[model samples]
Target: MAWSDLLAGFAFFLMIEGLLPFVRPDAWRRGISILSEMQDGQLRRTGFIIVVAGLALLYLVRA
Candidate 1:
């Protein structure tokens, strides 16, 4: 894989990883509970949104 792609994936993984320790456990559980309540269609739509945002940012900075 290209270094840029590798770095971008690492950055996004770090973003998600960083959130866990910073947020309170109770708050995190509540958030996950809310997420679990979402319909499959809604969850799929959310997944697409996240993918698009990541790709757009990656394309903007590609060298």
Candidate 2:
């Protein structure tokens, strides 16, 4: 894969993350941002879900 593809993926992730504060200002504000707003329990659950989903998607694509 080309470096441009990796850069493009990184840029897309940034654009989505940047828009989260804009779109959900209450749940994610300026000083107390999205990253800081997480509870440890919820964070763990969400992280698990994301990892599972990504792995499942990759499996489906490859299989």
Candidate 3:
């Protein structure tokens, strides 16, 4: 992909990452607190799942 494509993707990612906190700060805070209480292995597994899902989506979208 081009540099502009990469930048645009990053911008969209930032916008999405901000949505929950902007729309419902309380719920976002609660979610963050819940994540903070999770065990390391659980968090790692969650992260791995998210990464794999993202990659799968990107592959499907770009294919």
User: Tens digits of per-residue lDDT for model 2 on 1-63?
Assistant: 699987997898899889868888776666466657889997899889999997899689769
Error of 1 at 26 (Å): 1.5
Q: In candidate 1, what are the lDDT values of residues 19-58, reduced to their tens digit? A: 8758777788888899999999999999999999988997
lDDT for every model? 0.89, 0.82, 1.00
Model 3 agreement with the true structure over 37-63: per-residue lDDT tens digits: 999999999999999999999999999
When sorted by TM-score, best at the front, the candidate numbers are: 3, 1, 2
Best of the two (2, 3) by lDDT = 3
- Report how far off residue 36 is in candidate 1 (Å): 0.7
Given candidate 3, what's the lDDT at residue 54? Answer: 96
Give the root-mean-square deviation of each candidate in angstroms.
2.9, 3.7, 0.5
Q: Which portions of model 3 miss their true places by more than 4 Å?
A: none
